[model samples]
Target: MDSKYCPDCGHPSSIKRIDRKYIIHEIEHVLHFERGILYTIRELILNPGENIRKYLSENRSRLVKPIIFIIVTSLIYTILTHLFHIEDGYVKYHEVNDGTVSTVSKIVKWIQEHYGYANIMMGIFIALWLQLFFRKFNYNFYEVLIMLCFVMGMGMLIFSVFVILQAIMHFNVMSFAGAFGIFYCVWAIGQFYFKSKVSSYIKGFFAYILGMVTFWIFPVIIGIVIDVVSK
Candidate 1:
């Protein structure tokens, strides 16, 4: 304990203090996850920005890795949706199909059927848009990706809860999750990037809306390009 060297790294204690702390914290978090995954989920819900910043800048051992978290959440949501037969407005419209469903409804159904792919495609589009719009924040694509994974994973979890509730209560609140997703992203981005609450909310709102718009358009543009190329 009195030696001037880090016990873990064998470096000079003064210079390696931060590194030593990081290593200790990382080990503790790994042990914590072995105790329960709920601890990480609770921290993510209550203190997302701080936790995300920690994972991005410090040791990532404390939190579930972003990609794995996203995949797990997505799979849970997919299961809940199928199990509960929770049909969103779009899904309901798609089922009618008595020459009443619009082309958009069909497309929405297609997207829903391919939910995993759509989720990831939309996530990448949203992350790219965030990076472009918030370039001043100096977040690289990878960092933005981590942020999106957390936000989207949380959103999918919320949606899964809503789906379960709908199955039990026989009432539709599916759209509530989508609305919550928009607000959640806005609040999360604001908290993560901006110091001023008012400015952050303003920018975050615009960014979320524009991000969704871009996400929606990406598939349309790709489809058009494919059509043109094939023709």
Candidate 2:
């Protein structure tokens, strides 16, 4: 029996794991807001860079896993938008042919529907630009990707806040939400590298904006090429 458990953490082997107590405990923990999703959001909202740095260097257990955090947050935002019936520029792509949906339009629609998974894909794309701009810092590409998962996860929450406000106020505030979302992302990434110099922040802005532009523009270009080739 002892051999069936992990030597380090005493976790049971796959064959011995018939119980779902762990699953129930996790759900209870989240429902109670005890050092889980809510805690991660709070730390991220207040001091994302410092806290993420701490999570990377000091104690990983304090936060939800980066990828999981992003997925959960993205889902929350997705649900909020759906509940409010909100429309934003992020999903409004123009189709070239009338009565026909272009590949790019389909992609946009998919992204909107599955923002949780799509966020991870978008994070990977944005990480490339961050790697180029922040190469001097010596952080590897995957590290930037991890940082983005947390930062952009918070970005989703930030957008969710604006959505709630709009719903309550009965007015349009999505424009401000998008602008502030970008600003928060740039600031978080900048502060993550170093907060002393303005150069880090400036570079962060270019890194993020370029990454976003390249992500969207690349898809549009490919869709255009494919459309032309088919015609």
Candidate 3:
């Protein structure tokens, strides 16, 4: 696998490998604090409202609380991304001149420079739509929105961790795949916990739609807010 090093932090690559045993170990540790982490991940993946129901039902100690999880995960994920400078795709660079440039070439160049904003917009909408569909599984609209706040927050945490990894360790693996894999692991544990109660298709589809959408939504919202407030 391709790897990198962070010049600033000098934290070398410590990841040994990705494997079933390792994953199980991680889940086991999480189970100690919250058994519901497995089911939360599962409902987050398969049946959106189910997790919320369990969470609200006083099975409180069974999993990592969503709020805390979101805060920690977002920080780690963003830091990793920042450190490694991972790119979903390349951004076009354009030169800027003082004030205004009134030419076709200049306009195109400006657009290229600013094009990342557009990609972010599309990503947010798609993620919201996926969450919306998943919410239809059992949740009403408000609940779905609430769940999305936490879910998307987790995605931000994941990305923030990526930024940290990039800055501190010069680590940048494919992040979306990493997100999907982690999401899958969470779902698997939930399935095991729930046994025959939840449908596989529900789990699979939920992850597919929400995973990609969450990836885009959080950052875009933050970016928009910053832009609006700054103006």
Candidate 4:
């Protein structure tokens, strides 16, 4: 009879070899708070391009998966915003206008309340857009999504810190952070996908703009469809 192989450690396994120690170690490696998660977050923030390139080229076993990183950072962002009582300008605008928020405003508020999910949706849209815009690169949708997950996760982490500071300092810094995020996205794409800085910058600029427009327009289009269907 052939021996079964352990999928994780890639060694021959038997029922007798499965023990408490092995189970505990596996759980700790996969779910412990401090292992690869912190390292990946720091690398993503300090040296995103190189970090992403290394993950793409080298073994990814040591790093937290990009999707999990994005989700964790996004949850932290959401929690921080609530904890700090960070006021969104959109909400403030609607609050000041006749004390009656419109349907569009309501939609925007729902989107903001679920910002993490919205971000994932936007990431999908941007990935598709990039696949089309950079078709010559010949990268698949999943690869682009992996890159975007890292980029967006890093952006969210930076944005969350700025939000905390803005709350404490009583100054608006989100615009600055938003601008930096856009620039960082451009630089990351340039570093990973394009050989020429000039070409990458040009494409990244247009791609970012288009991404923003699509994100904003998508909700409006959906709202319109909903209204039409109800009527």
Candidate 5:
């Protein structure tokens, strides 16, 4: 009759069954949902800097504890995409009805058409640039970069799963979610990274603005580079 509280809502668990497998599975599901909501809540509640400090100073698990959250969020994101069929006008080459483009060509064309690939890469760069802007805070440049890289890895993990879902359902939500999600997750990382760099609250806010702007502009700059490289 031992009982536990729900990880997500902090509600008391009313175990419906005493079977070990069922209990274990149920607990895992609760923790998963709890993690996603917690990540979203924390991001919404604190300005980037404070959130970072909170994770940094507290338990190690708090830092980048968004893995389970990311998976859950991504799955829900996939489901919604399937249901709504939101259109960003991105089509894989072979899927195009015109039949003029090879699959690789279509992928490249899709990247060019919807501004997806570069925009996605820009999201990562913005996180890196933000970290550099606040280089004097505490950690070395590499350390900040590593943290951002981890953020990107987490982002790609969720994004990959979403892409798989899109393939199966013939719906295209992955590009939009991946692009925007990378921006947010990286920004989340930057929020904490800047706090660690700058001790003063005021400076941290400035860094946040700079980071935001850098994120917005990064795609254009990288697009130019890609255009040049392709030439």
Candidate 6:
């Protein structure tokens, strides 16, 4: 009779069947209350570039998956914003039309309401500029995207902390949080490329701002095209 374990390997005889249960079990076991996200957070805080580099090159068992990390962190920020009524307009805009919802307006409102997914979109936008600025580096566009996933998630976490602080202290701190988030992102991007360089860090700063501007410009361009097509 054939054994369950591999005859030569002494592991599962065949590949273990992967189903929804397998996925759930992995998430539950790895991302348990004691570790997982918390450990990821700590590592990212300490050395985001080094940790992310390890994630790509070395074992991935340590940190949470980038996609999952961003989703979870964005959810935390979104929940806190709603819970504390923090209407700082992180991704929102005031009415621009005469009670008519334009394409850009709708998109902005959707992003405001769904930060978890919106952050992913925003990350892609940021990744474009990052790849452009850091083209000399070995990292490709998708690699850059993965890096932004972790970086932006950290930014959301930063925002989440400030939102909680604003709620408790009754002092507006979202702006400060925004500054810190941007600073961290720039530093992480710079570190990812240059071990130590003033120019790389400076470029990192511009890359982030340009990435944000580029993302914002997309909705406006779409809105214009829609209006032109309808007219």
TM-score of 2: 0.84
lDDT of 4 at 81: 82
List CA RMSD, all candidates: 9.6, 3.9, 15.6, 5.5, 11.4, 4.5
Of the pair 4 and 6, which is ahead by TM-score? 6
lDDT of each prediction vs. the true structure? 0.71, 0.81, 0.47, 0.73, 0.49, 0.83
TM per prediction: 0.72, 0.84, 0.38, 0.77, 0.42, 0.84
lDDT of 4 by residue, 120-161 (tens): 777888887788778898678888888888887777887788
lDDT by residue (tens digit), candidate 3, 1-231: 544655668776565687998888876664443355445554565654455566555475654655555544444443443446554412222436667433433443443333333323333453455445444454444443344444544445444444544556654444454565446434542342343556544653465456545544454465556656766
What is the descending lDDT order? 6, 2, 4, 1, 5, 3
Better of 3 and 6 by lDDT: 6
In the range 1-231, model 2's lDDT, one tens digit per residue, is: 448778998886655453698777767665444657678888887888899899878998888888877888888888898899886733456656788878777667777788888778888878998888778877788888999999988888888999899989988888788789988998899779997778888988888887777777777787778878988
Angstrom error of the Cα, residue 152, model 5: value is: 9.2
Error of 2 at 4 (Å): 12
Lowest-sum lDDT 10-residue window in model 1: 87-96
Pairwise lDDT winner, candidates 4 and 5:
4
Report the lDDT tens digits of candidate 5 across residue range 1-231. 555988779887874667998888776665554345456445533564454455455543443443344334434444544555543322232334564434344344544443323334443554465556566667655444434433443454455456556767776666675465445554555466543443433443454346546654454466556656876
TM-score of 5: 0.42
Off by over 4 Å in 2: 1-34, 89-91, 229-231
Model 6, range 51-113, lDDT digits (tens) per residue? 899988897878888887888888889889988999764554676468776877777777787
Clashing pairs in 4: none
Error of 3 at 113 (Å): 17
Clashes of 2: 0
Tens-digit lDDT track of model 1 for 125-192: 77776776778887898788788787777777877777887888887787687787677777777777
In model 3, state the lDDT of residue 129.
55
